[model samples]
Target: MTLPFFVYGTLRPGEPNHDAFLRGRTRTERPARLTDAVLYDGPGYPYAVPEPGGVVHGDLITALPDAYAELLHALDALEEYVPGDPRSLYERIAREVIREPDETPVRAWVYLAAPSIATALRTGGTRIQTGDWHSRNR
Candidate 1:
């Protein structure tokens, strides 16, 4: 199956590392909206989760080379996310994302950060935005 990746952070093809992921490999990139979630500024990035009446707004881009699923999992987990490590902060989950007006729901993966560590969240003075990272130092 072609892995569909839901990009709500730096992977959205404009911020950092955009050239590495989106350059010359994107099949169909479109603005996507996922319901039942919200974006919160985590330690190094943003995270999303299902919240009543909440929605996660981002882009749904088809990544090529096929192995993007594994690659993305590694990249997202490269830092704070660890294999079988409860200490890890981020997690990858396959979720349903609405891509278009008439297109059927598609399966895509998104990295969700643990919200238990709200202390690490930048809740004041630093607002979070979709697909854009304004962090000075992660």
Candidate 2:
């Protein structure tokens, strides 16, 4: 079965990693938002953490089964997510994303910042209040 992934940072279309990882791999992509999530600057990238009144803007990408496997591998490596690894930078988890325009809700995989990392960023990193990495970075 195909799976959907919510991408908020480098993996979004026209971003640095999109061509390398998602281009020609995803079956469909549309603007989406993850509610109850705040985005914070993390050096060259951005990290997301759950927050009561936050909303993170991103894209929902659907991948075919074969492409999903390969995409997951590449994404995991890039996000430094290792299942059961204590030192992993990010944790891949399932979450609901609200599609734009119509605001339809859909479940998708999202890479969230590790708890400790999120705490660190919350304490010191610049919060992207707008939740848009491209706009915030630019």
Candidate 3:
């Protein structure tokens, strides 16, 4: 299934990687939020770690049909997500994200911290308390 992508960190609009990767590849982008996830500060990005009651603010991006496969591949490479690789930093998963204003639910691909990374983040990583990477204090 070709679902939209829920981007919470550098991949979101106006962020560093947006133009570099998603600028011409997306057909639509809008405000959205992922439930059960929180953001942790990475060196130059943010990691979304699943947690009960957590809410992550981001964008729901729909890729143009022709760009889907390429976009997916690029994102996987950029995120260092090797399927079934224990050392991968992120894991891409499909989840429901709530669109803003209407509060409608839409299934989208979300990059979450991998198991080990999540474990470390849960124990000692600094969280981006606001759940919005752009709002994090520098």
Candidate 4:
């Protein structure tokens, strides 16, 4: 089954990873938002967490193969993309992504960054930008 990846960073369209994975690839991108979220500064990446009323903007991409999944995973070096890794951040799971008026809700495997990752790379600062990976260290 193709998987859904919850991407809040540069993996979005027109970004660096977009070309590698989404370039010329036919997939559904949904406008989904996460609430009470804070983006954290990881060693070389970013992670999200639920806050009181903080909302996060992201998308849910569907119909991706294992290879494509790996390609999408290459974007984050902070977590292990292996079949089983304790230090892994995002997990491949199915979730309901918010769909726009003209959008449709499709089932997909989403990669959720682990909370421990948030604690590990918690630098206390993350900014929201369209298609740019935010890192306090950067």
lDDT leader: 3
**Between prediction 2 and prediction 4, which has the larger lDDT?**
2
Report each candidate's C-alpha RMSD, comma-separated, in the order given.
4.4, 1.3, 0.6, 4.6
Off by over 4 Å in 2: none
Residue-level lDDT tens digits of model 3 in 3-83: 999999898888889999999999999999999999999989999999999999999999999999999999999999999
Candidate 4 segments whose C-alpha is farther than 4 A from its true place: 1-3, 64-79, 101-107, 121-138
Clash count list over all predictions: 1, 0, 0, 7
The lowest-lDDT stretch of 10 consecutive residues in candidate 1 is 127-136
Residue-level lDDT of model 2, residues 42-135, one tens digit each, is: 8789999988889999999998667888888989999999999989999998998998889899999999999889889888889998999988
| Model 4 RMSD vs true structure | 4.6
Q: Report the lDDT of model 4 for residue 47.
A: 58
Ranking by TM-score: 3, 2, 1, 4
Each prediction's TM-score versus the true structure: 0.70, 0.95, 0.98, 0.61
1-138 per-residue lDDT for model 1 (tens digits): 456777776776666655665666667777776766667765545667555566676678786666466566555654366656667676667888888666567788766665454334434424344423433245
TM-score of 3: 0.98
In model 3, what are the clashing residue pairs, if there are any? none
Quote the positional error of residue 62 for candidate 4 in Å.
2.6
What's the distance in Å from true for residue 22, model 4?
1.8
Q: Write the per-residue lDDT of candidate 4 for residues 1-138, one digit (tens) a residue.
A: 445656665566655666665655535666665554556544455556544555556666653454575555564452354456766666555654445554555454445556665555444444443222432334
